[model samples]
Target: MTTTQNQDTLERLREDYPGWRIWRSRRGTRPAGWVATSLTPQDGRAPTLHADTAEELELQLKNPPMGIGLDIPGQLEWSGGR
Candidate 1:
């Protein structure tokens, strides 16, 4: 996909998963792959999530990591934030 499309997908993912930052690797752009990041000041370091494509990343977001059991829908809105 195009850069704009990739950005749109990233924004959507961020909205769906609060406290999650997802992005493509530096190898290229076009949303070829993704990495999910979450930070906790006291938790030390957390493992990041990777996906080969936007579709796969979406799957991970809906289900979530570490058996958190978050039932997220396909589409989500950011609501409002900085």
Candidate 2:
């Protein structure tokens, strides 16, 4: 995701979750995506799951140990013609 998208997700998570801490891990230059981990404020145990795309991020938000978080651009496009 792009930087813009990441920021948007961060804001949304903050508003929705409040207490859930959000951390991002960006790996690789191409096909870049973020790993938003939700941890317990006290123990900080294992993360719920890894969300890379917008769809997955949304799902995690709806049902997860954490909230909503995503990378930039938060969208996929395709082109086909002749």
Number of the top-ranking candidate, with lDDT as the measure? 1
Best by TM-score: 1
* Model 2 bad stretches (over 4 Å): 28-31, 41-46, 65-82
TM-score of each: 0.60, 0.46
**Scored by Cα lDDT, where does model 1 land?**
0.68
**lDDT tens readout by residue for model 1, 18-74:** 766777886653335688876432233334668898789777767655634333466
For candidate 1, what's the RMSD? Answer: 14.1
